[model samples]
Target: MSPQGHPWQKQPDWRILDTQFGSGNTFLATWLTWLEDADHPRLLHYVAVCQQPCSASELIKHFEAHPKLASLALELSHHWFGLLPGFHRFLLEQGQVVLTLCVGEPLPMLRAQQFEADAIELTLPHTCQDELSWFLKAIAHCCRRGTRLVMRHADAAETPGWPRVLTQCGFTLEPMKSDGDDSYRQKPSSFSGYFDPAWTLQRTRPTTKTGPLPVLRCAVIGAGLAGAAVATSLARRGWQVTVLDQAETPAAGASGLPVGLVLPHVSSDDCTLSRLSRAGVRMMLQQVSELLNVNRDWAPSGVFERQIGGTPKLPLTWSSEGTQWSANGHPDGDVALGSGLWHPKGAWIKPAALVKAWLNQPGITFLGNAAVTDVRRQGPTWVLSNNSSEMLCEAECVVFANANGAFELLQKMKHSALDTQAQESHLPSKQGMLGLLSWALHAEPEEARFAPFPVNGAGSIVSCVPTENGLTWFMGSSYQPDAQLERSDQENHLRNLEHLKELLPSLAQKLAPVFEAGTLHAWKGTRCITADRLPVVGPLDATDQPSLWICAGMGSRGLSFSVLCAELLVARMGAEPWPIEAKLARSLEALRA
Candidate 1:
């Protein structure tokens, strides 16, 4: 089938065999076709002969060159990179479509593999005209009665040869009308390729499964950035969600910071964490903009990443080709600074405002000061309890969204073992403090938005963000094991001022006139961390206990990972296809479960 044809046009259990795979175009086209069809094939076994397997790096380069195919190509490239030798399989749509890639000589490999196909597609390479007879013979040997073989013959003379070969093999040839026009036949060189047919045929057998569909209703225990996002997604997918928080208002935890920054978690190469974060950041910004008007409460100001002298340890490695830098001259001749893609789409969002927007949706319910004291399964439904020793709520599914609270609950349930044994540890801890300062800036809010700063300095890193109240300067976002939430206005002001002085010595020297007379307001909150330093978002099953779900431990990148994690959880509920990929959705699930 061509890229334009639908793979679901055929029978559900029909096996497809392809002779030639170039640039993986046919495979991609087939995958797209399957996505569009309602009753997709049960199994898709793609057998193609490739002289050389495309390297992971080269696949990425090709995707970069072709902007139109970038999204699909990049996803395929990621899968290709993860492939191992021998038979490799990927389950799509809950195992309805199984893509099996055979990476060797097609004719010999097909003979050795114990599988029969309902249809065979033979793509003759542009350079293999002399070997066409042998290829056709091999294909004929593989086909049985009722098998449909679609062969691509470029020249008119080869059409006669094809029919003759089919007759010799005790098969009948049907001369269907060609798809192209007279002009297409007149200008052979101008034709893009051969005809691609979309036909339907019955499968020889049906594929069967042993288990029933997993149905669940979940709860997210926090209404902060991570919890609110997760709840919104679950509710959108028809899951009953009740958001519980000890605070009077949503986003009263670390997400209480007046303005949270949105930046990708940088890492070397395209590892699982790096890829998930990159995609998560883009998805978060897009969802925020769509749910809440952008540039009003949420606006993405380009981030300025600077290194004054030594090489800095970046969360993600710099992609030399992917980065976008300013052409203007640098302020300091001694510094060699460069800027990469920070998501022109990335933005600073008012966490509280965003949470309220998500909860405003119909299916979501918010319960404040619920303070969950216990969570355990009561029959098939999970029950929640408060300090009063009374049942707070019950649902078929449950999610632990309160960061520290979730950790404590897991410990009590003895389900902590499931998380500790995973590849990416999910143990929680207190890591940092985000302090917000109310400052009177000399410059306009727009001008202050893009001001450059030293993010990795010895003192607290500060940045100016525009809010309805006024221009707010954020500083003293320190990481420590024992830092507590400090609400004292005077102490916060003095700490921010001292930290600002250490960051910009020249400005501090000239700021005596402004600092001595300037008024300030400040507040502090603690950030939660995970053992592997990545957010935990998915289903959990404790030893000898009923299943529980989680969506927490987002750390500083809560704004970046929250929405994506939510969408992932929603898709797991099996309501509909999410905007993100299936593999990524499963990646976020609790691996041990």
Candidate 2:
């Protein structure tokens, strides 16, 4: 849908929305037309809404009749099953074309989604318009100033004043060729300008620049899930990312664990973390399947979580059937959920492997044993250095993902930096004093050192984590707030054993032999947390951070939230549509809390 008398030409990052995606005909036609046009948008976000979408086979079978749409429909069929009941995102043409299919009533779907559409297409009957009101309301929510609306009325003559109604919805109708002839004023006339080139700028897409995103270099501290995910995301966007960590290799921190569970947090109110977790998990499922070995490095088969002290009444969305567990089912390993819900999409993952995979991406490089002590803004670049005053590296963009170390560094940078012109005045953390300042400031990290906001009160448990020995279960990552990496592994393992005893006594008893034999394995790693458990995913200012950003404080949900947080960070940096909503993005803003 062009703006002026221009024939539609290539316009990168154009959005085409179909209010009623019936039988997939409109989507197919638009896709084919886009393919035919040499000047089509570089990225086409085709959002389709269907109230009761047919099954993939049903839709495919119907398309078989149309030779023109067969091939495209077949390719679409592969990802068709992903369309469950709500929103399903499918990437095609290597992400050039993205299809966000909403399987629900049009009104709710449109209301839930936030996007600025360049073109809106709707087909209505010529007779009485039954669902016209709600449709217009939903359309208005997503339309921008220059958005063009295309309406096809079967009986334009019978539907008297349809164009007039459109005007009330803020849509100016261009003149149309009467029932037989042509040429009028403003109305939803023939599809003349619908495909014509009227668009000049790719305004909706995320890229603040006038042209393509420039080849940029960035340095990400920490090789754990958070840092690796951020590095991977930026690299995917053509940014040269160097992932530096003090550890010898990636995922050597909490992300180094052999197995981590990926599941959604459910709550009656569906708290922010719950919502963020679900979205994060949904996105992670795709990334893991694409990047790591399924069932080996990753598994989406499902998970069973046994609640203790009574399952915190889950939201209606998490209600599952068929699989019921009881904390007493297995007397030997007796941890029957008594009636725990099953997470069909919940899976176990090797966080270490995933981190390495991300680090291997085209533009990503991992620097091991490279500990970055502090960062200082020097004009346009940030200078990173080791404790010995040795320059580690410098880049225009610097992201802090080294967990609480980031918090410590920030505190050092703030309290120590003076208003002097000399380099020594810029920052002290780069020197040995940074560490001394941090230790002196909080020698006994108060109980409030780094804690969850509102405190989840919800403890964590890991089960069925694959390790060097065999399939092992890990539980109870005791939130030893401010407890750095000094805790003994044996002590934490024993602590975890106690957690099992409290969570599921019977199972604890069944596994008593391991404790008796001292064979119970455990690991200790610090989890970066904030006032809220959600990761600080955006700029430090909640808005602008030309070169500085943070993707930390994931707590223990690092595995579940890494990919989503990474993508959100990238979208923010590149100015693209976020994988989640705007409000949710705000909730995860690093500086918001």
Clashes of each: 6, 27
lDDT string for model 1 (482-508, tens) is 355544555555555565555454454
What would the TM-scores of all predictions be?
A: 0.58, 0.72
Runs of candidate 1 with Cα error greater than 4 angstroms are 1-216, 267-273, 313-321, 324-345, 413-466, 483-505, 508-519, 542-546, 572-593
lDDT at 559, model 1: 81
TM-score of 1: 0.58
Can you give the lDDT of residue 344 in candidate 2? 57
lDDT of 2 by residue, 465-551 (tens): 444655444555555655344455556556666665655566567655555565554555566666556677665532244566778
User: Among these predicted structures, which one has the highest TM-score?
Assistant: 2
